[model samples]
Target: MKTAIVILNWNGQKLLEQFLPSVVNFSQNEADVYVADNASTDSSITYIKEHFPTVKIVENTINGGYAKGYNDALQSIEADIYCLLNSDVEVTKNWLQPVLYVFKNDKKTAIIQPKLLDFKDKTKFEYAGAAGGFVDLYGYPYCRGRVFNNLEIDNNQFNDISEIFWASGACLFIRSKVYHQLGGFDEDYFAHQEEIDLCWRTQNIGYKVKYIGTSTVYHVGGATLQETNPHKTYLNFRNSLLNVVKNVPTRWFLFVVFSRLILDGIAGIKFLFELRPIHTWAIIKAHFSFYKNFFKFLGKRRKLHKKQNYNLHTSIVWQYFALGRNRFEELR
Candidate 1:
């Protein structure tokens, strides 16, 4: 299968300078590498041209964040599979071979995520995607080696392929045909959790999302949007709610949304107690934003033919907080 590794950049010149070499060195032989520039004001384009002359560049007219930036950039690229990689990831050698093997072998596999380890620590799974992704009944996304903020040490415990609920946008691989068919991510998201929505919708239409642990990459999490930023919290909280509204089955919608609001309130309260009033306020802002767009997202939900209920989780919040099941293996 023809594969293209596309990195979306928006004024992330420093990251490109630091991490791009590993990708170029490791991925160029297996796939066509492209840097989809999101109207960066910095010399990201110039640097790429001067240093890596062979790497392709797709310049977007505007910076559309992750969802629209990729949607707009991918239009002209022709490939059977597109790896929507983040700017701060350092891919290992021979990473693409295992991913390609799975795609060629399984026609129903629509998306795949490689094992993501931390660039900071190296031994721990990265926060963005740690041994693939799965969502609990409450729309909370966690990974095999990560739950809540607790990360498991990489003990070679997850070095195998498996099915998952979603693939992290940090290094997601998906078929080119399926991506366009789902109308490309809901650009309204602009960023955060849109990948989960994409994976959810992919399954809705009868496609599998897989995690290949054999292929690994290191990620510098929160390079573009810092975890401490209130805006990041706003997008994460708001977009997750929108995901539940647009993707959860009608039978569970009312209960899920109601439970989400209550849990969000508790989370905001926890943030307040932890002396992070900004995050609490951000959650408040996120909820209002969700209310403002609730009807609009409901219309989006109506358009989808399937709204699959989650089959693998009870409540990640309760499991992690109450039962103290911070490890993925401990979650019931």
Candidate 2:
């Protein structure tokens, strides 16, 4: 099977210099590598041209954020599988083999996430995507090795394949046919939580999302956007709500949105107490954006039947904060 590993970049020259070698060295035998440059103003494209001749470059016309950037770049590429990799991830040797094995074996699986660990610590799971991701009934996303800000120490407990609700966009493997069939990502999202929306839609149309924990990758979380960035917080909050509006079961939609509003308000207050008023304001702005885009995303619902291999009802927020259950095993 033909697999294309496409990294999305936007003025990320330093990140490419640091992490792109591991990807090319480890993955060249199994798949072709491509750096889909998002109209970078820096010398990123030049550096790639000089250092990595084998790596193909797909230059986007504009600095479209993650969603539109990949959408625009991928139209020209031909492959059976597309790995939407981030520029800041350092992939391990034999990473692509395990992922390809899963894709080849499980015909029902449409998307897969390898085990993601922290580049900074090496012992703990990364914040962006740990073992694999899932969303609560309220549309708050958590992962097997991560919940909220609490990251688990990698004890080799998650070194087994399991089904997941969503795969992280940081290093996601998806079927090319499935990706294009869904018309790619909703460009309005721009960035953040768009993967969850895609995964949700993939399941809605009858496909499983899985996590191959054996294929490990170290991620430098928040390289492009810091965790403390208010804009990041805003996209996360707004896009999460948009996911609920666009994909959740109609019977549970309004209730979840109402509950999330209350929950988000509390979160904003928590940020105030923590002296991060900017994030609180970001959340407020996110809600306003959500209100603006609510009807538009609501129109995007595919009205397809979605049956899950896992439980649909979960409240990661309550389990983490109120009950003090930070561990994935504890939640299970």
Tens-place lDDT digits, model 1, residues 1-332: 79999999988889999999999999866899999999999999999999999899999999999999999999999999999999999999999999999999999999999999999999999999899999988888999999989999999999999999999999999999999999889999999999999999999999999999999999999898898999999999999999999988888889999999999999999999999999999999999999999999999999997787684888999998998999998888
Best by lDDT: 1
Error of 2 at 331 (Å): 1.3
Q: What is candidate 2's lDDT per residue for 14-120, written digit by digit as tens?
A: 99999999999998778999999999899999999999999999999998899999999999999999999999999998998999998999899999999999999
Model 1 misplaced regions, further than 4 Å: none
Task: Tell me the whole-model lDDT of each prediction, alpha carbons only.
Answer: 0.94, 0.91
- How much is the lDDT of residue 175 in candidate 2? 97
Clashing pairs in 2: none
Estimated TM-score for each candidate: 0.99, 0.97
Model 2 error, position 206 (Å): 0.9
Whole-model lDDT, candidate 1?
0.94
TM-score of 2: 0.97
Q: Roughly what TM-score does model 1 have, to 2 decimal places?
A: 0.99
- Which candidate wins on TM-score? 1
